[model samples]
Target: MKNMVYGAILALQFLTRFPLPVNCSMDHNTLKWALRFYPFAGLAIGGTLYLIYNLLNGLLPLYMLTLILLTLWVFLSGGLHLDGVMDVADAVGSNGSTEKKIEILKDSRVGSFAVLSVIFLLLWKSVLLYAVLDSSENELFIIAIPMMARFQALLQLFVFHPFQNKGMAHYWKQHLSMRDVIIAACWVLPFAITQVTLIILFSLQICFSFIFGKWAVRQFQGVNGDTVGASIEGAELWNLAVLYSLFLFGIV
Candidate 1:
């Protein structure tokens, strides 16, 4: 249990900008465990956001809490995955063959399509958040959004092959054992009970992301870190979009 908590903190430190002191031994094994525990680390992030939401509640308006949480949420990752989503959008939007699109994605410089895509995604997400902020479903949002994003990230383990023989997958692809799967399942089960419909919707979105990611991976000949990050970001956005629409329909 101590190891798992340590693993969780290690995952949180790697995934977020939080200033937690966790110095694990620099080893391939440690990296793999961290990746496996990544979803659990998300529990910490969601819990923190919830605390902040409640804390800011009398001091500021709901919109302000929304803005603060939204900004911090992306920044927590240092906007790493968001950048990947932008690059992917640029590559896909630009008229090109598979090879060309992959090349565009690999380029370090940000293209016009990338800029527009990021702006649109962020705006869409914020608007969706605002629309659902006052709904009866808002509490569910606090739990689901972060959990869904983590689930999206975890899905990459099953959906796409790592592009390179090196990088994070060099560690994760090996350590994702049956135990890891059980752990992830345990993590999401309670949330599933809280809102079964939303969980189903969220699962469907994740499955869609997996399919899209598989296609993208095939086009690019397996998935790189960028593509994996893009998958998570896309999943997060799609989940929120579905939830917001459901909130309008008075669906729990």
Candidate 2:
């Protein structure tokens, strides 16, 4: 029970800018439990977004509101995943050897590819959010997708080998278990139950995560923090796009 409480704190502390009631240690046991709470962190993010939308929906124009939401969306994570997107972009865009790519991933400097990738990422997110927000579709998806995106990150454990036996994954992999995954999966059930129509959305994310997971395996040769973070950002954008598409096709 204590571990679960600490794990939830870790998830919120590490994943968001939200202020917390207390601090927690990041010991081995607590860190392992952290993966199970990743979904909870996501749920908090989505819920905040929904709350903000309600507060500002009428006061702000759709474009401004969408930009604000997008800004907060990135800001909430302290741009952690965007940093990953940039790292992965620079690494892959270099079109160099695996050794060279891994080297780029480690470099703290940003590159042209990183700049361009973020531009496109934000642009696409803006467009998609505009569409979704404008539609009469349930805004709950704004909440669900972020949680699902984090859930997708947790999928990294099951998806590929570690690029090396090092970093946070080393500690986390030690504690990775079916129970953690099951707990995380349960975090997703509430959204599905809330809207039967979202069943399709949930199924699509599972499929997309695997397909993207396979691509990451081939690209990086294994999972690393950059690839995993990139996956989270990708899943978030993909989820929004999926939501918009569903709205477009009258599926939702």
Candidate 3:
């Protein structure tokens, strides 16, 4: 019980900018068990977004609401996953050797590719959020997208080899276990039970994660923290797109 509490705190601290009630040690075992709480972190993020949406839904214009939501989203996560997206973009655009690409991923300096990718990603998410705002099923989406994205990250941790023997991804992989994945999957049950469509969408997201994982391995020889971040951001974007498409087609 104590470990679970510490693990949840560690997961929240790692995943979000939320203030912790108390400080926790960064022991390797605690960090490893924290992987199981990744979905809970996502749930926290989504719940906050949902609360903000309701608070501002009628007070602000759709575009403005979306802008604020996007800002809050970034603020909440400290742009962690988006940073991954940019790093991956820079690495991929470099067109260099695997070693060179890995070097780019490690570089702190942002490049043109990173800038462009971030812009497009924010724009895409903004548009999708705007569209979904008026849908009746928006709340479900709000609560599920982040959970699914984080779950995808967990899936990647289980399925892919870490590119390096150090860094956050390596540490997570070292501690990660099949039980962690199973527990994470259990977190999705409530959302899945509420709607069969969610189950199908989650299945698709899982499939995409595996496909993306294989591609990451082929390109980088294995996954890293950057790829995990990229996967989270990509998964969220994919989930939003799918939800919006279903909304448009009257399928949701």
Candidate 4:
């Protein structure tokens, strides 16, 4: 029980900017269970966003509300995934060899690609959120988005080989057992089973992770922490886009 509580704290500490009462321990054994609590952290993030949406809904213009929500979303994660997206953009844009690309990812300097990527990603998410907010039925689905995103990240950790021998990705790959994966899924399964639509969406997220894992492996020879973060951000956007598409077609 204590380990589980510490693991939850560790996950929240690593994944979000949320304040918690418990001190996070970095001991490898304790940290290994952090992945098990990742979905719980996502649930917390999603619930917070849901509350914010309800509180602010009707009080502001849709565009403005989306802008504020986007800001808050970024603030919550401390732009950790955005940094990953930027690093990935720089790597892909370099058009270098695999070794060179890895080097580019490791470099701290931002490039033109990184700047452009951030602009495009923020713009894309803001626009998508605005569109989703325009539909009343879609509001409730927001809580699932972050949860699915984190699930995709966890799936990647299980399926892909790590790019580096050190760092967070490698550490998680080393410590995350199949049981940890099952525990993470257990956190998400109830919500996913609530609706057939959600089941389909959940399946799509798994498929996305599979495809993404393959592509990441091919591109970098293996996935890294940056790619994992990038995958989470990408999954959230993809989830919104797909849900919006379904809404447009009157399928959901």
Local distance difference test scores for all models: 0.71, 0.84, 0.87, 0.87
**What is the model-wide C-alpha lDDT for candidate 1?**
0.71
What tens digits encode model 4's per-residue C-alpha lDDT throughout 167-241? Answer: 889988887888888989988888888876778778899999998889888889999999999999999988878
Model 2, range 173-209, lDDT digits (tens) per residue? 6777777888898999888678855677788888878
TM-score of each: 0.87, 0.95, 0.95, 0.96
**Candidate 3 Cα RMSD (Å):** 1.4
Candidate 2 achieves a global lDDT of: 0.84
For model 3, residues 1-252, the per-residue Cα lDDT tens digits are 677889999999999999987787777667765898898898999899999999888898888988998898888889999999999999999999999999999999999999999999999998898887766544777878888889889999888999889998888888888988998888877896678668777988898799889988977999999999988888988987887788789886
**C-alpha positional error of residue 202 in candidate 3 after TM-score superposition, expressed in Å:** 1.1
Residue-level error in angstroms, candidate 1, position 56: 2.2
Candidate 3: where are CA atoms >4 Å away? none
Q: Return the lDDT, model 4, position 104.
A: 95
Candidate 4, which segments miss by more than 4 Å at Cα? none
RMSD of each: 2.4, 1.5, 1.4, 1.3
* Span of 10 residues, lowest total lDDT, candidate 2: 167-176
